[model samples]
Target chain A: MDNYIEIIGFIAAVLTTAAFLPQVYKTWKTKDVSALSLPMLLMFFIGVLGWLIYGVLIDSPSMIFANAITLVSSFLLVYYKIKYQK
Target chain B: MDNYIEIIGFIAAVLTTAAFLPQVYKTWKTKDVSALSLPMLLMFFIGVLGWLIYGVLIDSPSMIFANAITLVSSFLLVYYKIKYQK
Candidate 1:
């Protein structure tokens, strides 16, 4: 049961982490982020950092992997925000 | 140092977890989800569920709290998506 649950965690981690990629791609292609919020992205970046700490504390690979990717995406979103501001 | 790190985790958890509120509020008020991605919200929901499981396995309150709140918000986003489709 634990293994099954762990697998679920991993699957979820991948899905959530990969989800950010498309948005980045969209922004790169369209360069339209009029709907995106700067404060939200900032908060998200900080939050991902927190999750990184939590992932380290718990030593969870899923957490680390997901947050690592998310951190990069959110960081880029900050730059995108400045570049593509409406 | 460990305690300090844990505090950082908790703080991150709160910021990330609470960050969704404004979007939800904006949607509630404006009924706008044109900028929001349905697939992204769905992926986020599943990922948060995974985090919840990971939190349980590791006995981490911050993880649980953050994921729990995020799960609720994402679930509502799904509903909001259905209701406010562009």
Candidate 2:
């Protein structure tokens, strides 16, 4: 059961974290952030940072790994939001 | 220290989960899913589902709550992608 749960966590992390890839790809390919929301990106960045801290404190590698990727993905979006948004 | 970690997790949950709102709003408002990738959305949906199971198994409220909201938001995106994509 514990192993099952861990597997679930791993799957969840992979899916959720990877979800941002499309946006990242689109943002990268188009270099367009006009439609992306700055406030939303900012909130996500802050939130992912919090998750990273939380993962570190809990010593959960699954959480850490997932949030770490999420952080980068979201950060890129935020960066682009600033760089490309009109 | 533990409390602090929990707090961090809570904040992380709030931020990450809330991060999807803008997209949801945009999708709803614009009724456009052209830029959104179906593959990515599908992966994210699967991943969040796994996280939900993990949360249930671990008996963690923070994880459960965050993933639950994420599930809804992502699901909406997926629904819209199917509905509005060109």
Q: Count the backbone clashes (under 3 Å) in each candidate.
A: 0, 0
- Over A1-74, each residue of candidate 2 has an lDDT whose tens digit, in order, gives 56766677777788777777777888999998877788888898999888778777766677788989988988
Q: Which pairs clash in model 2?
A: none
lDDT of 2 by residue, B1-86 (tens): 66776777788888877877777888899998887788988998888888878777766678788989988898999999998887
TM-score of each: 0.88, 0.88
Q: For model 2 chain A, give the 10-residue run with minimal summed lDDT.
A: A1-10
Q: Quote the lDDT for A19 in model 1.
A: 68
Across residues A22-57, which tens digit of lDDT does each residue of candidate 1 receive?
888888888998878888889988999888877877
Docking class of 2: medium
Candidate 1 residue lDDT tens string, B8-84? 77899888877778888888899888878888888878888888887887777787888888888889888999888
Give the Å error, residue A55, model 2: 1.4
Global lDDT scores for all candidate models:
0.83, 0.82
